[model samples]
Target chain A: MTPIALADYDVVYRRPDALTDVQTHYCPGCTHGLIHRLIGEVIDELGIRENTICVAPVGCAVFAYNYFNVDGCEAPHGRAPAMATGIKRVIPDRVVFTYQGDGDLAAIGTNEIIHAAGRGEDLTVIFVNNANYGMTGGQMAPTTLAGQVTTSSPYGRDVDLVGMPMRVAELISTIPGASYVVRRSVHNVANINKTKAAIKTAFQVQMAGLGLSMVEVLSSCPTNWHMSADGALKWIEDAMIPVYPLGDYRVADAVEPLTKRRRPDRSQNGSLATIPEE
Target chain B: MAKELWKGNEAIAEAALRAGVEAYFGYPITPQTELLEYMAREIPKYPGRVFLQAESELAAVNMVYGAACAGVRVLSSSSSPGISLMTEGLSYIAGTEVPAVLVDIMRGGPGLGNIMPSQGDYFQMTKALGHGDFHPIVLAPSTVQEAVDLTYGAFELAETYRTVVVILADGAIGQMMEPVVMPPARPVMTEQERADWALRGAKDRERRILTSLHLSAEGLERMNQGLQNKLARIQQKELRWQETMTDDADLLLVAFGTAGRVCTSVVSAARRAGLKVGLLRPISLWPFPEQRLVELAERVQQILVVEMNAGQMVLDVKAAVAGRAPVHFYGRMGGVVPLPDEISAQIDKLVSEPAGGTGFKTGSNNGYGQPKAMPAANGVRA
Candidate 1:
């Protein structure tokens, strides 16, 4: 028998309070909405909503300042890390992070991100990789997959012409300044859970003053991919995952033990878990 | 509070430190590297102060944008080319109304010209500093002590107006040494106050987003109009200049920065020759001391505009004179510092023919190398 009452069951999920009630402008099936929710959820769990500053990059997420209910400023395309560095260095106690997309982080901003990472700036970086430029009408991005077709790569991405897709996580992990670096996907429920855990670890890395930390989440852009929402999710699992494998490429030894157990108060049951000190 | 002999660059750096600057980020460029180096040496002395030699001018300015937006007193210094690289960031800072200080120890150039001194950046600093309809408070100091004072005052002005304040110094000033009585350090914005103005976590207040990008035409118009009003207020309240011997003079020498200092000697020499010559040194170049210049133009028989470049500020002087007094220009171009004797000669010539026409006149050794024939346009001479 079908239940007539919608409020018959306990509340299982809802939007994070850290996120504004205003609807975001993200296109349908764009995983940016999911990524924003995870970030908001993490900020809510840490109770750092009031003390958080998000540097919104210039891309599809350029208006991220409006999306998050935290103090933020827009950075010139690819300069979010530099701005975050300024904010954190000026006010060290405040939590600061940069939200950037594939084109924003890997293209024009390559020099800035690399230098920011090399300096071991105490900030978090949330990078979204969708293989193509979602903004400016699907141009070939630095992270565009080999043989992937886009407006700039009308004849499919030519490895010989444009080189292989940049493995940002792998490149960043090589830097000694990067204390924690991980790549995760949000294509499925299981992977989405891992991605949230990685995001939490990135924040913890900053909390411990363990230097720069980054989480690269493989996202799907159904509109830019010219595929249905379901097909784009399938492509992320089949094509994107194989190219950018999911793993923790660099977790400094000091960070290893910290990630083992969760903070008790940060439970998902709407109750404070026993936060035991390690 | 004791007097100490300091180079202009070093004086500016010490002044910024005393002004309670929380952070200093810059990239090394000629004539201004000492300023950066001084910060590197001194920042370690203060607890919680930050100093960084950025990877590039682009990065340095963006970092400044961040620090400024966060409601802290911050600064950066560079030469002509480096400041050019920073113009884009400066535009963003202006649009967002972020308070910050930028120092330019000018050398020659449209490109990587030279390490020698030149006032060629006058138009660049006063008129077209950055894109969009924004104007920064441009201060030009002649001596090391004045450099220290202007640099110290610039921080306060930036905070007061919530806008960028530029200390436009020449390479000569940056390299020269003079005694300066440094200002005592005053209290700066507290962390809480800074966070209140900055995007320092929206923990206690509604989220504040510092941005220059306004999509709505009406919204952008309001922001731009607000900036214009601020600039108008700054122009009215902050016009600074020094007049020496202009009371009964038939000739007035108008100059600023190092060139203005040189004109002091020229004025004295012209007076020794029994000519009533005076000097008007503008301490604030952007405000241009136009109102005072207009008043002085009525009394003086002729005005001699002297500089180290191909006549930039003279245009402003001419505009201020507005045909009441004929304005003649004598300048050395491309980093060549004009000699007092040559400036005196120009003063003598302009005074000798008080009713003469107005045009540019090149001094010997046009800040470049050897002198060339001048473009003889309407009494213009080399």
Candidate 2:
């Protein structure tokens, strides 16, 4: 094989140590690569590479740990939140987050995420809503559009049997402990920038010691949708985006103001010898 | 500190508290109710301890599941029927390899049998308690001290092996008061110890995931093999039991937990009557004291299996002996506790009779025949 110039590495834009050397199994022009790049950029920007831990769920993102240049653990289907809870409880100082697909996060891990949010566990969740279970051959996800067809829902998702698509960002906003919950898309350059901003905000909320924060990214699976990359972008804008509208559901401005208080250091105890004799 | 008077159930609760258990999730069940009650009353007195009264046994087990998933030392206690309800959660915990403690202060059971003491759940406990292939490290405490000691040991073992550990006792043991020396306090991991994996309010780091599902067949098989390897190592290193008066005795008595304590009395009484009888009390139900019994079976002419149920552990004893010695079973079930005097009387009857006399053969090769066709006068199986 011809050795490529180091300057060509900028095209992939991955960390030197990041383990995505092998080509991804994603279809041509799929946006999973873009989202992965954005998340990697956020980790690098925050300087949390050493102390950060990523939870990979059982989906297309199951190999998420491989792409992130940090420690990671894989969770069973839809159980990333629960597993993240375990990891966080033991390693409380480290930043923890779950990278999950729509099917894994919305369909199976609904209870785990809901309860974790309700309990105000300090963790970040990166929810990728592609409207289908992209990994296991295309199948309808909980976030699937009403008329979207997949392997499992050949006649398109029938609301009567499968129920209406879940609005995760809206649902999570109802949780009292959720300090930040936002839904952004990754179809176009503008939306991808917005999605990265939302992810960064979620991490900032956790860093501010606020509470549970989640960023739901409306993504595309072109091959699964049997559409070209450009067609998939239009499909998300015309179909997926309407059902799963993108916006910030909850963001606490009070957190920054509240954390600004100057507190006295009690560790020195006034040098102990300076204590006045009563 | 020397021994202090304590109830077995209270000791289990206190030991758990001292072991830095982060949470206690349980419902009230007779005999074992004291364990949960103690936790409720005492857990709050200590900082960092959480106690929750779940809606049902099912809820209690699931709550433990939730807390244990958080990598916290969580525990639950129940009797037979309650344990049956928690079996589903236990199977999940085992499947996920979540470390937690489950205390079963046993009572008589096939259904809601009785609230009194019984060892009937031996098979349900020692064998797989739920569907699918898995076993929890089962600790059977014969004394109040062991109950407390084993509760501490269970937590450590559970964490070490990444599996559930069951502290199996009976109503009599749970309720009975005895002198126990409390374990000294050990250093519990502070927030620093858990900073690597614990989800203490997420900081600016990466996310962590903990789970047990293997989607591929190859992944599942690898997980199962890993668990089996851990179990095999535990069986080799953690199996424990106690043998009393076995060297000179002609008859060996095999029992566990409360049944073993009862057998002690029977052995003492038989010895006073000049009948040579010994007792084998198993401390760990799983990785059972089979080899010890196999060794004892070689010397003893006959073995008497005593329990508070219809021959559950007897089958294990029989399996261990493998016809090396004639194994006889005598038990009481349905909340009917057999008195030590009655067990002694049965032992006396066996000792007084000559080999092959009284229609009961006394040889290693003797088959497990019908129970003499004797009348079930005492509500016990003949």
Candidate 3:
């Protein structure tokens, strides 16, 4: 048992101070936990844990208020954007954000999200797109892919009847108020790292006072999807990404320098690839 | 300044602004559109105050909810159909125990009824604005001046109780112009004052969480009990009503808002005609002045309830009377404002008809013949 060198092995994990020391209610193999950790890490990296306020939506992430160590409030159904806009307007210096799900954002809250983006509200939005309503037991969400089977759409979705699934990232990017709108997946190591970078950049967009920034992350609900954890992750790559493509839909010129500076020297203090807002 | 004529909606907006409203969110709806319009014009004049014309009433109410959680004096206004869309937001505001004020200049509706004035929201405001075990503190204003005063004080009441305050006026009060003496301006709530409960990014303090959802039944039940206790305390301390000539009276008139304003003339005319008739106009509709109704019931021979709705508040009046006196109601629905003469005639009909007023007798201004439509007149409101 020779003494290992300090840098001999890779570090498995370091908990973000922005997260509370409690068990999360998320299911096993769910990407919600991974995404939450990314947000926590971003908050820590930016030193904005004390100044960030989150508006949690009314889906599976309704209890997001409990996991985050930062200040938060709950918005009814698809109303996080409206709620976050309110907090930001009253206290413009504060960093305000909303954590929403597919059913909450793409379904009931389309109007609020669209209006908030259209208003060019200075806010960050982390939209978790998992095809169906996970909390309500796999109902057909507005983001449900065509030919996708769900509890409400047992015989696969009918494009003629219900129409194609909404491409939220692309749709929101079309709004003039949108400064940085991107879609990423959290199914694998490479995509997960990209998702984290996207989350950090979106927050930077808010801190930069550019415009409304949102990252629509393609996630999995293995329990609801009736698949094992690994299968669900694979499903996101195989099925979900085609219907909801991953990439930047809108990027303001002001945010390009921040993304261009991505992880140029990650060995330098931290793995987070964010430039501090001046 | 000396009393100046002000439109009801605009005056309420001005009063709310003077009450230190930092943010005002609302949708454009008839009867109350002028309130939102005035906010749009006036709020931006201030350096930091906010006025947003939300996409809909739902958005407006939620904006109010968000601002309230931030611990600012925020308000929104709408008429009936618009207010109906705000119930969910109002419920969340209530459950979160954050203060918010809403001015509902009611219009006729169970659904998009009309733009004319009506008291159809009697149940909606006092009993259930949304799905919850909570009642908002409701203040009814009968005149432009009263609307100004109530709208000004609504902020303080909401913040003091950490609950929702609804200023319940109607289209007649909103659309009509009358003399109003505006109150002196109050300083907007400083962020320092909101340090206790508001979520201003949790700088230099522990994180704050405001939400209405309680996952466990026990947790929700406790929250419900807490809300119930707050309401009960409000009921004990905040009963408000105006009594006109109830000392020596045989016939007592009960009403609120526009109908109550018209009842004043009815009382004066009856007194001039050598009748001892008094009026009890409830200013607070939720606490409802039930105790005073009981006291008045002890002295009066007959109690006549007048309202613009077909008979909503009369039910409450009857329950308060509790067989103490014969309770009779006369009302006009579908946006018809009841006239002083019509109310006076109904009082005569009630006294002449029977000795025992056990069951609630509902009479209409429309004679039994054919339910003919009356011209939508401004009537006493003008």
Interface RMSD of each: 0.8, 6.1, 0.7
Q: Encode model 3's per-residue lDDT on B16-110: one tens digit a residue.
A: 98999999999999989999999999999988999998988888889999999998999999999998899999999999999999999998987
- Order candidates by DockQ, high to low: 3, 1, 2
Q: Which ten residues in a row have the lowest lDDT in candidate 1 chain B?
A: B365-374
**Separate clash counts for every candidate:** 4, 27, 0
Pairs that clash in candidate 1: A50-B203, A264-A273, B333-B367, B336-B367
Index of the highest-TM-score prediction: 3
Interface C-alpha root-mean-square deviation of candidate 2:
6.1
**TM-score for chain A in each prediction:** 0.92, 0.85, 0.93
Q: Report how closely model 2 matches the true complex, as a DockQ value.
A: 0.12
RMSD of each candidate relative to the true structure: 5.4, 9.0, 5.5
In candidate 1, which residue ranges exceed 4 Å CA deviation? A1-9, A262-278, B192-195, B353-382
Candidate that would win on lDDT: 3
**Candidate 1 residue-wise lDDT, A1-278, digit = tens:** 97678788666577787799999999999999999998888888788899888899988999998889998899888888888888889888888999999899999888888989999999999999999889799999999999999999999999998899999999999998898999999999878877887888788889889999999999999999999998999999999999999999999998886567654353364422324465
> Per-residue CA lDDT of candidate 1, range B1-382, in tens?
6888999999999999989898999999989999999999999888888998788888899999998888889999999999888888898899888899999999998788999999999998888878999888999999999999999989889988988899999999999999899999876667655635677777656889899989899999998899899899989999999999999776788999999999888878766766677999999998789999989877876678888888899889877777777677888988999999887766655544423432445222212222212222233222
Clashing pairs in 3: none
Q: Tell me the deviation in Å of residue B244 in model 1.
A: 1.8
Superposed by TM-score, candidate 1 places the C-alpha of residue B224 at a distance from the truth, in angstroms, of 0.9
TM-score of chain B, per candidate? 0.92, 0.90, 0.93
